[model samples]
Target chain A: MSSKSTTKRADALRSIEAIVQAAAECLGRNPDASLSEIARAAGVGRVTLYAHFASRAEVVDAAMSRALDRGNEVLNAVDLTGDPLLALERYIDAGWHLVDQAQALLAAAQRELPAGRIRELHAGPAARVEALVARGRAEGAFRTDLPIAWLINVLQAVMHSATEEIRAGRLNPERAASHITATVLAAFTPPGIPVPEPRGGA
Target chain B: MSSKSTTKRADALRSIEAIVQAAAECLGRNPDASLSEIARAAGVGRVTLYAHFASRAEVVDAAMSRALDRGNEVLNAVDLTGDPLLALERYIDAGWHLVDQAQALLAAAQRELPAGRIRELHAGPAARVEALVARGRAEGAFRTDLPIAWLINVLQAVMHSATEEIRAGRLNPERAASHITATVLAAFTPPGIPVPEPRGGA
Candidate 1:
């Protein structure tokens, strides 16, 4: 292939990355952001955007995929190897920022993607929680009376609820991570046991 | 009014009641159940069904309303007085039955109704939970460290997650209420406190 052709390919790839990044920012701020707004945010023209994505749904899907990729990166960095309770607190803290970044984009994705497709994309994060919960239960740090899957489900539910509370302005965003971690730790503590305190205290 | 006309009016009212009842049952069983299936369940002709509901969305809305009405009746009968912990257990038990009956209908409603409309319809139940959580916190039966609204939101989220778990065959239906009560009680207990045991024990 000619060097000129290779340069054109690199430029096209750069354009697509810029478009997806702008889409994630725009949709993350407002789920109803328009395609024109996204194109403008990317510093691209409508013709260029249309050259890539065919519709709003396609753009939203790409943005969602990018957000999930970013989420996986954040989640992968957390050291989940210590005491289950402290590890859970660390995970919740990181997870909160990811949720904060991707929430509005999630709303947009829900509108544009199939429910099963979204669930499929979430499998990675879910598996991480499942593994942690299983380990916690094995170590007797978490309750074993309830099914492992249900425990994981409850944790996810609480985090999502915290996000909603923040969105509605009922929860203080600054303290959301601590509140979530505290609530989840208590919930996971086995019955007849005293709920554990976080490193800095509740 | 003439006797013949009065009887005709009464019969029309009865037919509408039957249609709504059938709609609730059909949609409660299958969110994707067709209008024809609802008509069959109602023992009415498709023309009669169409005469009352202009479209499938209309029928689903009516069905959802009926289901919520039924849910209100069930919730109202629960004695929410005395011993906040026990009251919570009773509420969870009653709420589980309500969720089981209305889960599919809720799916149908989500597809057909505006999100705000559904949230509006849910105001009654949410209010009940909020009132109970407030009472529990004031009595020192529940934690006050977390905001009351966040706590209530977490409870609702856990309950919803339990319903999903049951639907996915991950949670045993018979054990759901106890699991929900136990998990919620632990989460609500103030940090450093030993989680309370349910009446029947966790």
Candidate 2:
């Protein structure tokens, strides 16, 4: 509550981010590595690392939390109100934009920790997208067979994969994101439902 | 050209599959293990292993190649003639199925082989998917801004991630695949396009 305490807390938070960033870098390079090495990457003594977090497991969890926070921020802000499906396009674009920033560390983390809570955290945008899917389905915009959660699960996987491809230089990020969005839409568009051109009323 | 040669090749291919499967098991248990140990897991003598594949890299590649072949089969059999979009859905579904079979080895191999030709050899499905996207765009069913190649890349990555989530037990395969397909679809479906749910129309 006091200035000194606040200062210390801020410093601790900064240190934690530093540690997570370092671990992310290390994990990116060596998916199979030890905790001590991660500590070295973070530029802190093992004891200091231990003082903040108890074990390698804790550090990983913490780093994942930070990563998820960044990922969720992107998912959370997607505008989903207008032209429901097209709104979803903007949402996907938002995700790519967010992912672009933490691309390297995030890819490594996703690869090593596929089902971790980081994914759960990234599920934030997913929830909004699901709501939109349900609306689309109920309103006859999306496939009714695509139950809400199932839809999110597939897209989440696709988003992660798309990010990796862009990072690997095999695909351009913007183009990849757009194509993925369109392809997925085409797959789920209930047969007979042809997409209208931009701003044309269906 | 003889029956004996055909049998020999079949036997050799089976052996390689076993070897790769064993190597995956080993990597799952021990990420930093060596080839001699993998040979032991495969029940092949180290000399015989070398005879079949010159190095660890080759063995890994062959293992991935086997996995890639399975993926190729799934893509090849998917009927793309009907609704270009329905074909797309079946293809994505097939992808979900295939990624389940040898995903662990794919993961381990991908982690190590960044510059690998895994994508090049696996481009068969990508090309088809790209064609579908082009078709959709031309049909006014998809976005003109989306790049065909990048869409394939992202979908491929997400497919891998979703499969791993299923393997990890955090996500049910059915639910995850459906969710992924929907989200990706939302992004891809053109603004105001009506997805036809034309019943009884595979």
Candidate No. with top DockQ: 1
Over B1-202, each residue of candidate 1 has an lDDT whose tens digit, in order, gives: 9999999889878878898999898888898899989999888899988888899988888888878777888898999989899888888899878887688998888888876678778888778978888999899888988888788778778887877878777888888888888889999997778888665755
Off by over 4 Å in 1: A1-12, A33-58, A197-202, B1-12, B33-59, B114-116, B198-202
Interface RMSD values, listed in order for every candidate: 1.4, 5.5
Docking class of 2: acceptable
TM-score for candidate 2: 0.67
Lowest-lDDT window of 10 residues in candidate 1 chain A? A193-202
Error of 2 at A185 (Å): 5.2
- Native contact fraction of candidate 1? 0.84
- For model 2, residues A1-202, the per-residue Cα lDDT tens digits are 7999999988787777778888766755565556788878887777767788876656666666676676676566667886667876777777767666556555445555545555565566666777887787777766666555455655565666666666677676556555556655555576556754433211
Tens digits of lDDT, candidate 1, A46-110: 99999999999999989998889889988999899888887888888898888877889998997
Worst 10 residues of 2 chain B by lDDT: B193-202
